[model samples]
Target: MLINVPENVVPDALRGFAAVHTDLTVDVERRVIVRRGAPYDGQVGLVSGGGSGHEPLHGGFVGRGMLTAACPGEVFTSPVPDQMVRAAAAVDSGAGVLFIVKNYTGDVLNFDMAAELAEDEGVQVAKVLVNDDVAVTDSLYTAGRRGTGATLFVEKLAGAAADEGAPLDRVAGIARRVNEASRSFGVALSACSTPAKGGPTFDLPEGELELGVGIHGEPGRERRAMMTSGEIADVSVDAVVDDLQPDAPVLLLVNGMGATPLLELYGFAAEVHRAMGARKVSVARTLVGNYVTSLDMAGASVTICQADEELLRLWDAPVSTPALRWGC
Candidate 1:
């Protein structure tokens, strides 16, 4: 809404982002954001990307102990294969590169093509798909479950492995393991407006909410009247916990969908914790905030990853990224 022109939104934002994030090399022409000291010798490269509007996701996660490079697409649209090829090439060290792709049709297809292109260029590449959203078996944008909050978990844990000089196979293994262990569910309190549309993408009447909503404002499982934070948490947590059926302590991500205030998110988090307790699920680590977001969508999603000792350790490893950083 504050943008000068809808057409230049992505490029204009990239310019400002480049100016602010001096540690990253934001190639505006290529639309690839890579760490300054990329191709870290023997370390396997980590690359992930998706549509824009979800700030601090692929782009903001590009830094030490996280993504080596990220390719950003236009709002709610997948990046082309060229961007992925360039990102893989830019970050590929002697070790192979790992592509952490979300399970969207456009993303999967584009990343698949990019892997082939990168490999043809002598950059060995592997890929792991993130499909942790448990709301539906399939969605408008995906053949399978849509990738959601677990993307941050996969990027963080897998990035740590890569930072520790893990081989391409091992890094990919960690990513796959994380994905297999995670589940997410979202609720939408309001619809988001896109720059291109300049209006609400979907119609949501006042005092109603969409349960099990997708991040891109897609139709969800059901619509219901407005519920209290505790009631919403009960439903969201039940969805994830029932699907996950965790045997071990879990890593919890109570993520905001862009427009929700921290005040509401924290309160909702309290209810989520309570719900988990009621379900007899132990939470090992809790992260609450707007990590993965839908543009100005006032809602939240709950992501639960059953954490093993290794996963917890990798999570605790030092990370220095714009969006998520600790122990650095």
Candidate 2:
């Protein structure tokens, strides 16, 4: 069974979501919002997003130590310039705004236009495109890579630094560090429905799984026989840790794609913890749940953050927002 709606439905939902955060958001084009008053002088405003199905992502990450605004797109479509321009204006303080965009064609183009618009308005605009999906080969079709789970880690960590009053350059540097050290790979047990498509975006015949699937319905590296939760966790975490070789203590996240339940996520987290200890790697802390996701993709992704002293401190800092709030 498939369930897709009109393409514009997601935009409508975004508009309504923004209305609730009137003090923190604005649905100017009906799909975006700025989080607060103009960023403090010498403070950098952060912006991020991609498609809509991955809710509680870009938007949920808005607030202290997260994002200043989030521009959402239709189901899986990238948001256009109109949305980005409005968000940029609302958040631009004296310093500048950092666009934390995932590596996707429409997202890059639209955000680029917004940057031009902001620069014309005499605001400094810097952009960091995240492409941490190691599953995607560095090749044609895309502008080199794809951004996956790293988007969340970068947003929260970078926002943490910015909240500490770091300059745009320094905050951007921290974001880059997070990106360079993190990698993600996902698998889909079942396909998700798209509003525009009105049905399951992809199909998995019953027990087969697609490994390394992209968040936006792209085909993954390979499909394989199914395995238990612990084995799945072992394989995915191995891919991430092997790529990073993060000698320092690291932050571990075992995340549900969207439809996956917390019970499964907890089981996945336990396996991740066991595997890391076996590798002699230090776990600074662990965050488990659906922090970043693909519509209803029934899968999980693992992200490892090799944190330096400063970064760990930032991660520990308090953050208040619709999705994540702690250390209050």
Query: lDDT for every model?
Result: 0.93, 0.81
In model 2, pairs of residues that clash are: 4-198, 5-195
Per-residue error at 69 for model 2, in Å? 0.8
TM-score of each candidate structure, all chains considered together: 0.98, 0.94
Residues 1-328 of candidate 1: C-alpha lDDT, one tens digit per residue: 8999999888998999899999999999879999998989999999999999898898999998999999999999989999999999889887999999999899999999999999999999999999998988546655889999999999999999999999999999999999999999999999999999999999999999999988887868899999999999999998998888999999999999999999999999999999999999999999999999999999999999999999999999999988888999
- Report the C-alpha lDDT of model 2 over 18-115, residue by residue, as the tens digit: 66766565664557766766565667889886788887788888888789988887777888877777777777777788999898888888889888
Q: Residue 319 lDDT in model 2?
A: 93
Among all windows of ten consecutive residues in candidate 2, which has the lowest summed lDDT?
1-10
- Model 2 error, position 137 (Å): 3.0
Best by lDDT: 1
Worst lDDT window (10 residues) for model 1? 135-144
